[model samples]
Target: MRIYLYLIAGITSALIGWNIGQFFLTDLGLFSSFPELILYPCIAISLAIGMVLNEIFISSPTRPKLCLKKAKFPVLIALGLGLIIGLFSGAIAQILFLPFFGIPAVIVRIVGWLLIGVAVGLAEGLTWRWETVEAGDKKRFLHRLIASIGGAMGASFLAAILFEVVRVFLQEMPKNLRLAEDPIGFSVLGLFLGLTFSLTSSPSYLVALRAGSGFEYVSQIFAQISPESINLSKDYPRIDQSVLTFVSDSSLDRIEEGLSIKLPSKGSFKIGSNNDCHIYIPSLPDHVATIEIKSREAILIPHVLYFNHIAINGEDLKTKKNIVLKHNYLVTFYSILKGENNSENTIIINHEKIFRFVYYNRFFDPQG
Candidate 1:
């Protein structure tokens, strides 16, 4: 379903680009003749539109945070290469139209347009490659570049077909109404060109990325926090014969006394009393016993990247004491707690058994 949508978008964008290209040909002459004047704004607008669309559809769950930051250098390099190539192609076309070459002006102009389109497409494709390729695969630069160029050429051919159709339509319109003369009208036309190119280019780029090493790298990045990880933590709160319960309903309370219990293969848990005993009762006296629970036993593994902590119920019991049993022998309780060094931290427990861990950045929210 998503693939079809992307294809549709690509086709639509190509049509739009063709229309815009036709307008530029009619109003400003060959894109090669005014490469900087014509191509620069078009590139800027198209890239801006592409970035917005990428953020909306592609970034979440797949691309990492600060994707735009990572893409800056790549985008710059691609755009520079495109502009240089476009200008050079245009210059060549102009030379071919001279008396020495004896090439028809119209033919030269048409060829120039094709070259510019191909250059821009290739550059745009290269930009996508940087975002999709894995850091480890940077050595395979030539292979990725060749693949991007091929995809760009295909996209440009599609755009050319659309441009011819738009040109015919514009020719049918009244001469005065067909072209924009004022600044406001030109701005609108530029925006239209940008949106059209973005729609077409993004879909094509995504398809190319999927077909090459791009998809592999994107999958690798997302696999770190995939559904498997979430599922592993989902079945954390089950109970059996033995339960390890906290003394206070709030995990923020300082626990001075520790308790020891021979938890069955399946473990159990409950909240203990606030009094000196600080233990969950109603179980066999022989099986459950209270001892001095040290602060270090209740460990907080801070996820610095996410600003949350995975509070292990008794990590020390498994690691230090080497306690073992059946069924993995490890009873894990996942909780999201918000705190900093020597601060009043609180854990938000939801009824759905899902933990919402929030950490307040002291620099951002001092009161938190």
Candidate 2:
């Protein structure tokens, strides 16, 4: 289903660009070489934009919090590459001039479009590479770059071949009096281009949550509070049990545990007392905090209501809107009602519900 969507988007973009170029060609027919000058550029620009949009659409579900500001450079790269490849293709085709070099025009056009696909892939790969480079790991840079670029080129090559096959069939069809068959080949090329790219691109990241060093404190408190424990339901049976024990002096006998969950790599997730939140903490207020896990770092944004009670590494987040979470950072969400003084310097009365997790930069694999 998703492959179909990509194909449809790709094909539609190509045909639309081609038709728009044709419209311009007909409207401004003063020069004989206008079609040659205008048509390929239009197609290249459209394909470039289409490929980028397709990549975004495919990646948006997993990377919902991707910042456009950060993507400006890569988008420009893809557009530039696409235009250059298109012009190069046109020039090569004209210079070679169909069988002058003993190679077919179709082959030259295929190679040209192939390079365009490579451009799109290279842009996407660079975008992924750029995000990970900020994490200070240069070891995997070359490997990742090769993987992304290689996958895109491979997919584009396959798409080009498939498009050529389809074009052959289209060419044999009866002369079209109404609709031109030229756009059909472009549509086919676009369709396969998107589908193949999707297949070849890296898999989306899966967030990993394990018992961090801070969990030792919580674990010790849990052991001291209750000697005997009853079993609880596990939300995701595949992963390790993520248990959050709510221990109080008065409620030692009734130590309740909430279902712990691993956050998805999708950038933004709401965590609160609300049942609908990604992570539910009973002591925290409804919609207490938002966690945005990007390619480089994880950020925690506490709701204004629980500003005084929440603290990261003993420092209260009173005036701050969000904090970038580092490895072993203890994000303590204190119970507001049970606190003695809710001031920034003073600690809350019951601070046991601490979210202690390690942020692993390696968890986000651009190659995969």
Could you say which candidate leads in lDDT?
A: 2
Give the per-residue lDDT digits (tens) of candidate 1, residues 1-368: 33344444443433444445557866768664544345433433343334334422442324444555655766576556655765576567657767998886546645654565455445554554445422123433445445445554444444445555565676787877456322222233333333444444332111000011101112334657685633222212211222332211222222221211221222122321212222221111111222221221222222222112112222322222322122112222232322353244434421122221111111010100
Best TM-score goes to which candidate? 2
Q: Candidate 1: which stretches are off by over 4 Å? A: 1-65, 99-102, 132-135, 138-144, 180-368
Mind giving the per-residue lDDT tens digits that candidate 2 earns over 1-368?
A: 55776777778878877887787778766233635445665676676666665555454435644635444665676667667766666566566654558887667766766665666556555555434322133434455556656765676677677767766776677778224656866676677666765565433323433334222323545755774652233321122123222111111212223212335555677666676665555555667777787775678887776676667777777664888777446566665354445665543435654644443333332211
**The 10-residue segment with the lowest total lDDT in model 2:** 244-253
What is candidate 1's local distance difference test score?
A: 0.36
